[model samples]
Target: MRFLLLILLFCFQSIQLSAQTNNYSISFDNAVHHEAVISATFKDISTDTLTLRMSRTSPGRYALHEFAKNVYNFTAFDSKGNSLKITRENPYEWKVSGHDGQVNIKYTLFANRGDGTYSQIDETHAHLNIPATFMYAPTLNERPIDVNFSIREDLGWKVATQLPHVKGNTYSAPNLYYFMDSPTELSNHKVREINIDGQTVKFALHDPGTEDEADTYFEKVKKVVIAEKEVFGALPKFDYGLYTFLACYIPNASGDGMEHRNSTILTSTRTLANGGMEGNIGTVSHEFFHSWNVERIRPKTLEPFNFEEANMSGELWFAEGFTSYYTNLILCRVGLISPEKYVEGLTGTFNYVWNSPARQFFNPIEMSYQAPFVDAATSVDPVNRENTFISYYSYGSVLGLALDLSLREKGLNLDDYMKHVWKTYGKTEKPYTIENLNQSLNQYAGEEFGHNFFNNYIHKSDMPKYNELFSSVGIVLSQDDNAAYFGAAVSITDDLNGKIQSNTKIGSPAYKAGLDKDDVITSINGKPFPNGIQFEAFVKKFKPNDMLSVTYLSDGQEKNTEVILESDPSYAISLQEKNGDKLSKKVLKERKDWLKIE
Candidate 1:
């Protein structure tokens, strides 16, 4: 009787402890009207210093933005309203000292930039983009978060957020923790709801058009979501929301969509012309798929995100690149995109990957780790550019395709890989390591596939066997004939007067002419080539092995040499094509069967 009583007491204590450890609440007030106010309440159960943080950077963007600078009128108080001193530790972090078990921090955030935390002041309506304005305790990863928002907009203007509304225009959620830390796009956005697989999905557009267009776009998007869910076996969550904001006259604005637990904010060009729907659909698919990869199954480095500094990871390729790879596949599988279009996209990516000089220098995995710094730098020193760079997107997509093919070749398939990854990593509460990735792949392959594959391709500078992979899939990867190229690859810089200021890469012809880096090419073959276009035009007329009298200013001395133009193998991918024989009849039949098209 004594032992049973002791057991009951211990079980009751454990339940109470669990409840105490997970307590947290957030309340948002728009009573102030000018700025969005957020109040977070939590119990401090640890000895470590309590810190509040706003993300320095989002997944889609490679640049770091100090979001905490936007915060204003920050004040922390004890349960009895006594002011507690809060210190600004960094641009994106704040530290509170002398805080015991329970505390509440209140702050007013100015949302004015349409890009991040933004608000409109005109008479029409008021808008707020949430992620930029709301601040949270960075260390409370596993705790439940509740938000109460009071929004102010035009009398008739409706507000939309991924959070379930407890009252009119006011939203609340049991937990804002985990990847659910999504920004709210609160505006007079046009709302359209559709049901797919018995789940309701909402689409909110900044400048939505006619009812017919909305219906058409929503139907297509619904099909896409269904296709992805079918492949993954189930949707990540029951409710999902998409918020799209369109911008006019910006050069593919540097921003893209960001994934949250139940919502995504997609920044895109306003013009819906020239197949804009296709681009929008593709973006939607990519961001939506993140609900599976980065949101649930995350890298160890990403779990306790360093909002003040760069969180480096070697697996962003898998997080982002694999997402890129699967987007097209899902689109094709759903009949949203034709096989020819898919092949064309893959061909373009291949050409881009093969032509870049960075491929000769850095492997994909290395590029993944150094992305935060290298990706942010605008000016690339010519010498370093040759050795330490590659596009993370391109490298990742290529590997994604290669891995998919390898899986299919082994009869395991991408579907199997996705399930294995989800079961081992996605379902876990903790982020995964490189060892976890290797173990998952090895389990599916029943061999040391990860070791052999990464050692040769990922960790090394070895390129993928594109020819073999594409052929196996019945897709002919072909190069276009009219692609432009210089007989020798040359990186050029021009002066203010449009004259050749420097030749960063001295091709065989330029090298033979005694031209070096920083050499000023005054003229090509006697005629003055004043600019890049003119220089390129002059080079185009010359055939391989053709000799020309080249004149340039080298070290303030006029030099001339008989230079022979050599063919550039760097342009090989442009010249290469998947021959008709490469796409065997068997593979073509499989493509027909999979696509349900001839």
Candidate 2:
């Protein structure tokens, strides 16, 4: 009987070894006028159906994207050179059947101007954002997998991946587990490499212009990275990389970021020459912290990714919000930003959440599960779209700050909770739940911090005591009044003549003015307002309760109304350093140190 048991154990080990030996080699070589050919070969697979997926969801966006919709010219073949039948099972997944044994799949992926997929124009440049094109099987959830890629040598293209490079033009990864664990961004983006704390970190992006400007911007990023690592103990992997692709010019823009194992892809407006460093640093810090929080210690639903549909989890707040909270905190700790700057960041989040009308409609958890559908349905209407949706990023960050302070008030801090989380969920390789988080916090705070605080404040609509929390840390949250006030959040369409030809409803006083969806605001208060600046200035001149006459063109017809001016409910938060006795010097000192070198 003992001998039989030994044989079973040996068989299990052999199966594990065989699974580990499976590998994938991908080559992106055929670059025609506008399209690129991607070929992938998989070894030692016995499944009758091989499923390839174009991920609809990415790390940063917290939304579903139909990535396979972007792919074209897909085909699959068996090892014997016989054609395999391929069928589209869903928008994001494809199934290839009749695989005699091993198989090779090749497809031509279209590169569009959108941020997620493979994008290219001329030989001068190309961008390969992996989630948009790369497809994998559902069976290999946490299985070990490897990927190798060969690219055009003369294109002057440098590939950046979180996957470790085994040799020249050959990259080796631990498994399909780690492959999806990290997303790769291959582009002609600019590259910078720095060594800190015995780890080499690489930053790659398209060089927009001016060496001095680039250096100044990246130097601040370097400092933030160093500081974040110091706080987190050490980066989880031996080597790390950051890839930023400037797909287009970004001027005061907003976008999403996708986190991979060792790398992340950020889509944002082009960093301006002035203060670009600060902006880039903030972005880098947010994405980098995901290395610990979400990528490793993920919600159970996120594990064994369900590419066909949404993997819903109410804990997205912890995944994204905690990362957002730490990003600014790390910046403050590293001295890249002052304590005032850190507070200002938190205040921005606070005001954003407070001003959002959706907070009244949906709790943070409900919004987490429903955001994908809501965002997709309302993609066209900017105000109605996101205003109705809650961001774990915004609210979660605030909650993180509050939770940190609450723990501190009890003679503990986020560090203890984080350690508890890492041990209870991250170390055990388990999923996150409210119960688990509460239990962990109970252990750390020596009381039921999770149930007592999270249920009352986070899971419910109860407004958090931001003033009290910030006061505990020697920061005061202030409301800004002098900022421009538009009674309604409006989206304007410019005519060929560059005139504001149309204004769309974005849930404001304008929406309540019996204004139809596409009303062309010809004039406000008897003044011709043809542009945003004019509209903003016109709105600011009137105080709340003032009577104003308005004229608009609807469906090519003239319209008029007598409307009452009202205050814009949109709130913005500012931070001030407090030197009062509300917080003890010892508490302030501890909080400051806690943020720094965490």
Candidate 3:
């Protein structure tokens, strides 16, 4: 009965930011401890009892991470600075009673992982993903929030995020959704701002590399931003008056990139001097393109993201996969990667989607729905994921390739389709459905093309006509079915015991060598196979008809097997130019224009 007061108070504060009612302030000590002390004070109270919750799932992540698992030592106080009774309602919610009109809550956050999905804090910096760091009351969800980071000034840490900065270390967000969607990075980082046609885009860098390296990388990023803007015809008018790219290239940081409303978090363990820029730029391109595709042109199913449950959508193929295609396309158009590299990347996607047996069972939409289980989701039991599922990103990119080539053949291309969708659905904050996308395809192209494309490629498990489509642009599509075969998929768990655990396919080289499942591989050709990676790397050097000796342990008994490796049936995709095929003037013209070249 007493908890009801807190719920009521939360409701009252959820309205709007007025008279400091919905205001929130948090402070943390920048120390190199696994645990960080966080004090969150909720101001302008309404009820006596207060309730707060930690998020279970974050935006862009389809999996439920149970972020509450990291929070501990929660306590509450009142306006008179008196202690209050706090109760653990559930795994995610906390209930407090006997509080005054206001509440001052302090808790400990245990964060070690650093990526787009999780939060991490240390002596150097703190990557606070709001969902993993801050707790919000259910009633106060709609209310505005003001965040102030009180850090160690001697450490030289400043804030970089899309949240509207009011003054000093204070920031303002319209609601909890926007607040949580903004990923904040704190470090004594270099700030580089560039103006793209009057729109301010800033880059906050946490790199230990040379200034020249940083400049060269961000210059390419500027080009990517401009090229993507050309695709959308304009940028999303950021409510914060600017957009930001928070990039952390520290060796201790994890490699990840997550998209946000008007910013992105690009973290990698590679320093700038290592030439990690090229690969990381793909992440930058992909996440930035999402600022248009998924941020504004959001799907109705995902607009109001539920932080407590898995968020599913059928639009990711276009949302993520088409963005995957554009990630590479933008890089290629900006001349960051060679045309051959660009083609190789697409061919890799093509080979993955087409060669995987999963395509026979799932289409792009079904694949998108499975994101909750596969996208960063962990599983304890071993299952054959490779045989049953194809990543929507892979299939969607391949679909983008086939469809773009198809459209180009008809004198209509993906750029036109993208522009049409942006104008129709993206510009007005109108959520889109698959039917809407198909309708746009129908309106721009012929109705028959849309029907066949969606029905055969998206809804059904049938490979698109890649050969004919590529032929229109003079890029011949051929396959090499007879290629060097590596045995069954190498299953490697990041653990100490280096063993062959999976049931290798019958008659394969490893199987023929009498290397049974669960056999602890001791050595290969006198080289220690202490880990799966070393073994795989050694095997990659072997070709068809190669002879080898493998040593392993079965039932704790050592054994040696002499085996002859054989070729596995596979296909290779190469461009017509690479294969010395004819490139007509039409093909050259289509390629140049499609790549945004004169």
Candidate 4:
């Protein structure tokens, strides 16, 4: 019986090893042209022709980048270096014919944009978001990937990636899912290694910053890592064996950060060398939290990410929003942010979510779906994003904050619930639904409380009981009735104009008076408006329905109109310190445990 068990295990291992055979090689010989040359070879051709596809979108990003649009001069050749006949099936597909049992496909990718979504190459370095840089044969998407970075003799470029290294400049991935998820950088970057509770963390900065500030910057990031480790109870068993932080803090580089299985791409236009360590903390902390949330605690709708089409999901509220909520919380707990500053940040979130009219139109789950259009996706036409779409990031974070307080009152905490969910879905790479999340919350807390909380706050447009929940944490969610009022947002474009930047909200006095986004506010009540604040202050002196004569520009023509002033929106939260007696011992304890150091 023991011999049979061993034999079975050996067979399974053999099958796994034989399945990983995808090979890829990329060279930066054409980097000066803002292009990189990629060649992929696959043996054991099962057909006379192979269909290759360039991804239209990337994982972790919801927009369709149309990566194929950046590919030029694509060609395929046989093992003997014979040119193969190719057909353009569509914008995203290339049909290659006349390949021998082995095929080598090559293409030049023009990448000038720098962000989390696209590939950018130059004489200095090559920054690749995998899907934007590589094309895969359709049937081989499930196969393992082996990559070799062909070195330039004089460039002194070194590879920084989370893909497991098989040899020098050669890395291996378990499958295309993992391959496409790994972003790579090739440059003569500086390397710093730090030991964080036994984990070897590599920080690869593309441009060498001041050694002193770099150390301080990384130490702040180290604290965030430790705080999040306590939330999940343990760091994930990274497939690459260690973690990498690919930092690009150089002038002209766009600011962005993207998460992956075992590494993150941190790019910034500003460098930490010149006292920019403070700015680096918030963003790095957010992406690091994604090391657990979106990357591992998989969302069912987004699990098998569609590179060919737009990928939309309803769990971004938790995936991104909850991570955002914890971003600052973790920073504060680590002493990077003062307690007062942290509370001020929290107060800002409450004010935005509570006062913004967008919340009335879209709930968190509803806003999550808007990611397909709003999250890094571009459109050729104008959009009314300001008054319609509320970001799930802000909405979900506020909900997360409220839910945390509510759970704590019931003798449970959100950290406990998250740990439970991590054990069930995240660690296994098993994608989950909103229902799965609700059930988990119910299991941790009472079903009635969990169901009501989710339905009222997440599923519906109704907000949570913030005033009640905040008291338990020794915080006050206060509103001032006497706060001044205005119904429109005005922006100064130049000396000649202060434009009404947003189409007046429905029922707003400006909306009733027919003011729109491009209308230039030339003057107020027949006098020069001068600035937005002075105009707003002049209007604030009146009550709702009070009238004023306004002058503006429409489509390059001058006009005059009368706009009534309306009362400010009803809900706003201002965080104020509580009196000594109001903050009970129980409230103090709750606040301590909620933001306590790990």
Candidate 5:
């Protein structure tokens, strides 16, 4: 009898604690000026002072955004309508005292940037990324969150979000983490949904295009969803048995894609009738893959993502890069792109990782650690990233390609390996370490193969035998030995002087000759090049081991130097038939199986 009473008492107390909900209401009457009036009400306060803050970082992002910089017109009130004392505790935080058991706080948010990272409000629509639009009390993080949007019905607006709908214009989140992850979009957009395995997948597209264009785009989105589902064997069990693609392809939106627990934010400035029909689908393939890879098969370093500071992780190579490797491959598998185009498309990323000097300083693991500084981070001073960094996305994608081909050589495949990982870590929602991935590969393949791969390519930054691997599948990895390489892009000014566009590559002939960005090339080989086209044509005249006298103006001073030209260190991937190489029966079968083509 005593034990039953104790259990009942605990259950009753739990309900009471959860009932202390955080209520928020936002009205966009002043949305024409790119502003929103947001208010938060906290009830059942038990402390002498409550600390509230705007998030410095958001999920799926590594850098600090300083979201508090957009907040102004702050005020607070008690239940009796008396003003409460508020003080600035820090750049992102406010401390409120002299409040009764209940307090309401209001502020005006100036949001104009429309991307996955920030909020935007205007006469057209209100695109809200939760971290950039809302503030919360750290002490009340465990309480339920309720948000009401006074939407502009005059503009035929509708609310679309991953948040569970409570009633008209109201949404609810179980806790702060889920609330922060749910971004909402209010606009007059078109929506399409498909039911798969007892779950509904929705595509809410806010684009100014014809209905036919919207239908065509949604069909492509469906193919992407199904293709990615095949990789992981099934769709993730979404939180509410639903998943949404909240895409804003409008002129005012910035290009970005961010993955959340149950939805993804896809924003771009290209509409469906424009180049977005092809340009934006790659982001779709990349972010949907994250539904399984990073959202659930999470890195331990990013688990319980911090909102007060930057979040760093060393697993983004696999988290981001492996997904990148599959991005276009999925498109090919679904017949959206031809197999030849997919194979040829590998050339750009392959050459980028193969020829970068940054690999000498950091392996894939160390490169993953640079996310906080390079991932959407902003800085005023110039950086030497040309010599120090390679995007983990590109690096990891090529690595994933290598591993996939290597595993196929052993009568296994990456699909099975990913399924094993999904069952072990992703489905269970268990955070993983790099060692976990190593062990997963060991179990899927063998200890010897796994150890060799991680030790050489991942830990030590050694180049893979890509030529031999490509040959096994009847693909050619070839480079021109006689192509001239100047290794610096130059733009011709209206005066016909060639101007360097960016930092010169570290070991290129241009860098060796002391050429840098903003340098104007007045004369080359003792001749003044008339235009950029002519300058490029002139450089093609020299072969490797040739020398030329170059003159340029750097920082308003004329300079002269001798540059030794080298052959272009770029590789191309193509089908054996395209290169006129005979494909043996075994190689033909291997290629067919690799590309799933008949």
Candidate 6:
């Protein structure tokens, strides 16, 4: 028995030593045309046929984006440089056979979009989102991976990525998941770094702006990193003791922010010298907060994220929403935005979530499940999203606000609760479920408190008493009682008529009056509408409870209706002082503690 055990151990060690690494190389010979030549070499193959596929989904995204459509000129070869047989398995996959224990495949990749989920290779830079640029074998997913980038030195391009560097222009990943999560940017960019709590955080700015602008913007990035670190009580134990921010703030880049295990991609068309200095920092705050929230304090449903299909999770409310709540709040805490600006900015999202009829259809959990349909998804069919769906981002953000203020009423705060969660799950790198979140809250703030909060908000669509909650912190939630409401968005047409641009809200006056998208309003109050003015100004002439004879064209048919105007349902939140209300000592203390004001 002892001899047999030793022989088996020796055989396992031999197999491990013979395991192969998937090697890839990318070059931009036709970067001017937004094309990249990529090749992958697989060695020591155990199967007679190997399957290669491009990922249909990307990290931090919930939708399927057919990456295979961008690949062309695909060819396979054996070790002797002889051509091999290739078979089409599907639109996303190809099968190669008759390889002599090795296969080398080359393909042309056409990438022009510059965002978090897509790859862009142009004369300015190569912003490569890994999954959108590479093809991998599902069978050898456990094997180590290596990539070498042949950068264009004439363009002064340098590589910025989260993948651990093995040598010059080459990087390695432990497995397929990590490689896909690593997006690379090769540009003539400036880099700024800081060491926090013994871990290094870097910001690589790819922009056409001055060095001073880059320096000013990187200061905000540093402050965001530090503020978010304080929320989780510490930075995540980054692989290789490093975290990177790959930022592309240029004229052609699309605005997006995506979080990964060790880094994030920040792309925007707004340059730092122009509006982006303040405009882009909000995204910076949001994505860095995700380093602790979704990346490490992960959701079990998103564990081992699927590359071939949309990855959905019911916990995006807490994962994405809570981070969103802190997105602006952290900026306020870090002095990027004033406390008044932060509080006042709440009005837009507050009205969006509070007044939305979508709450009648789905709870926060169910809203989170709608991610695949709405998270950067594309479709031509018209759907009633305005009436039936609320973004999980807004829904969760408001809930996080409610929960925070509710906890403060009980002499606790959300920061400590988040710290407890981070220690239990994020620091331990443990994937969690919704019940686990409830359990964690129960452990921190008693069972009854947790149960009621989750039951009322998470499991059901019941709204919290936000009016009283805001009052506790000396914030005023007020609405205009006399403002007339028009629920459908209207645009002025070229022929000087009001065109309804979207579906009216379910319970609004416009909906009750049968007004809908594409209806051209010809006259109001039995008089032809005067041209050369905005639609909003035209609507402002009427007051609440006023009756009007509205005539419009629906399906090119003239129709007239009696519409009774109702008061606007929108609400605004503001500081007590801003509203001429004195803050009591108790309310003042609560407000100070909540906003971390001096």
Pairs of residues at least 3 apart in sequence or in different chains that clash in candidate 1: 131-183
Residue 376 of model 2, lDDT score: 34
For 1-598, candidate 6 gives per-residue lDDT tens digits of: 9999999999998676445878999999899999999999999888999999999999999988999999999999999999999999689999999999899999999999999999999999999999999999999998889899999999999999999999999999999999999999999999999999899999999988999988888888888888888887889999999999999999999999999989999999999988899999999999999999999999999988999999989999999999999999999988999989999999999999989999999999999999999998989999999899989999899999999999999999999999999999999989999999999999989999999999999999998999999999988988888888877788878887789998889998889999999999999877776677776666678899888798999999999987788888889889989877799999999988988878
Query: Can you list the residue pairs that collide in candidate 3?
Result: 6-49, 6-50, 9-47
Residues 1-598, model 2: lDDT tens digits:
9999999999999887755454555555555454566667665666888777777765444456676765788888988889999887567777888987666887776654434323443354445555555677666544555566556567666666667767775666555555644555444566677876566667666545566765666677777776666545555554443332232224422354556656666655555454455565676788777766876677876766655555677777788888888887877877887766666656556766766667777777776776566433236643543456667777788878888887777777786577668766765567787767777777777565667776776678567776776666666555445443444444445551112323323455655565654566666667665464545665676677666676877678888876665665544343333433355677557666666533
Question: In model 3, which range of ten residues has the least summed lDDT?
Answer: 480-489
Tens-place lDDT digits, model 3, residues 328-399 = 889989999877778766666776677676776678898999999998898898766655678888878888
Q: Write the per-residue lDDT of candidate 1 for residues 1-598, one digit (tens) a residue.
A: 9999999999998776545443323222442344556677767547435777776665444456566766787887766778777787567777876666566787766554443223322222334444455666656665654455444443344555666655654455554343335455544556677665556667776543555665677777778777777657876644433322222112232345666656666655542443456667877788788778777778786766554566678777777778888888888878888776776667667656665556666677667776677654344555445334666777788788888777766665766687788877776645887667777777888657878777777777577777776666675554434433343333344442222333434233554456565555565568764454555665666666777766766667877766666664332221112442445577766555444465
* Cα lDDT, model 6, residue 574: 91
- Relative to the true structure, how large is the alpha-carbon lDDT of every model? 0.60, 0.63, 0.81, 0.81, 0.92, 0.92
Badly placed stretches (over 4 Å) of model 6 are: 1-19
TM-score of each: 0.75, 0.78, 0.87, 0.92, 0.97, 0.97
Better of 1 and 3 by lDDT: 3
C-alpha lDDT of residue 276 in model 4? 54
Best first by lDDT, ranked: 6, 5, 4, 3, 2, 1
TM-score-wise, the better of 2 and 5 is 5
Residue-level lDDT of model 5, residues 1-598, one tens digit each, is 9999999999999878656879999999999999999999999899979899999998999998999999999999999999999998589998889998888999999999999999999988899999999999988888899999999999999999999999999999999999999999999989999999999999999999988998998899999998789888999999999999999999999999999999999999999888999999999999999999999999999989999989989899999999999999898888888988999999999988889889999999999999999988999999888888999999999999999999999999888899999999999999999999999999999999999999999998999899889999988999988988888888888788889988999999999999999999998789885563655667788898899788999999999998898998989799888977799999988877777667
Model 3, runs deviating above 4 Å:
1-16, 44-48, 484-487, 490-569
For each candidate in turn, give its C-alpha RMSD to the true structure in angstroms.
Answer: 6.1, 5.5, 6.2, 3.3, 2.0, 2.5
Name the 10 consecutive residues with the lowest summed lDDT in model 1: 243-252
Q: Which structure among the candidates has the greatest lDDT? A: 6
Q: What range of 10 consecutive residues in model 6 has the weakest lDDT sum?
A: 13-22
The TM-score that candidate 6 achieves is 0.97
Q: State model 6's lDDT.
A: 0.92
